[model samples]
Target: MEIIGYARVSTREQNLDLQLDALKEAGCKLIFEEKVSGVKDRPELDKALSYLREGDTFVIWKLDRLGRSLKDLVYIVDCLQKRKIAFKSIVDGIDTNSALGRCQFGIFASLAEYEREIIVERTRAGLQAAKERGKLTGRPIGLSEDAKRKAIAAKRLYENRDYSIDEICRILHIGSKATLYRYLRYEKVRLMNRRNK
Candidate 1:
């Protein structure tokens, strides 16, 4: 029954030394470490989970280091319980192999899932209400009037053959090559429509 540990830090600037030291102290022979945000999937976490056998124990320095959301934490722990692999959160004092830990965690997981559902329902209601009120949700307005004018300028600059696409983009303060190409296409279509008319 090996004790495998996983450690995570959200950004490149953060350090994992403290968590690593703790895991080493806790008798973790093998530890996985990664610098990744909890919101995004961590490849190292998957690797660590895969390394565990049915009887092996998975160790983490803290619960938050494992997951950003309570729902995520509960789901992961549930999976471990089903696999009969023990889980230990050193900071939270949770050990799934124990009867008390199992009972308390079940309650915690249910509460977390319940809260997640409530949050989802509220967000959906809010979006529906905004749509009814004719207020734009999701991504805000894309192209501005100034951007439209710049698109026109981009077309002219490209046809003139004096300035490069990069030069035109720099002149217009366009951020990406994709956006520049899109603007150029929009202008091309507009010019064609005008000629056809």
Candidate 2:
């Protein structure tokens, strides 16, 4: 039976040394390490799961190291159980291969799921409160009024035969084709409104 360990950190700046060392001391025969955010999909984690077989053991330093959500943890543990493989989280003292460990895992998994649901509910409440308060969040407009004015002038110059689109864009210092097209479309809509009036 192979003892496989997995260690992961959220970002490149975070270190995996401690987890790796602990897994090694725990007698993990092979260890997989990846620097990836738990918030994002982890390709290595999927691969590690795919590599498991009956009678093999999977180890992680902590429960959160495997996954943060209770649903995620339960899903993983359940998958391992189906394969008749064992799982252990060193810090959390969770082992899913044994009877007592199995009972504890169910409790831990339930708690984890509860915690995740609470977070989701709280986030929804916060967003609803923000909306009620009329507080706008997220990135500000990409183009300011002054930039719009410059874009309009440049587009007009191009349309009037005073300059080519490329020359006008270069003179205006607009960096992208998309920006130029946006300004052009804005001007077209303005002209259409004038015609309708």
lDDT of 1 by residue, 1-197 (tens): 89999999998888999999999998899999988655677999999888889999999999989877788888888898898899998888888889988987999888997898999999999999999999998765556888799888888876776777678778889998678778887777342312111
CA shift of 118, model 2, Å: 2.9
Q: What is the model-wide C-alpha lDDT for candidate 2? A: 0.81
Model 2 poorest 10 in a row by lDDT: 188-197
Assess every candidate by TM-score: 0.62, 0.57
Supply the TM-score for candidate 2: 0.57
List candidate 2 segments past 4 Å from native.
Answer: 7-27, 32-51, 64-84, 137-143, 157-176, 189-197
Candidate with best lDDT: 1
| Residues forming the 10-long window of minimal summed lDDT in candidate 1 | 188-197
With a 3 Å backbone cut-off (N, CA, C), the pairs that clash in candidate 2 are none
Question: Each model's C-alpha lDDT?
Answer: 0.85, 0.81
Cα lDDT tens digits for candidate 2, 6-79: 99998778899999999999899888887875576787788888888899999999988887667888888888
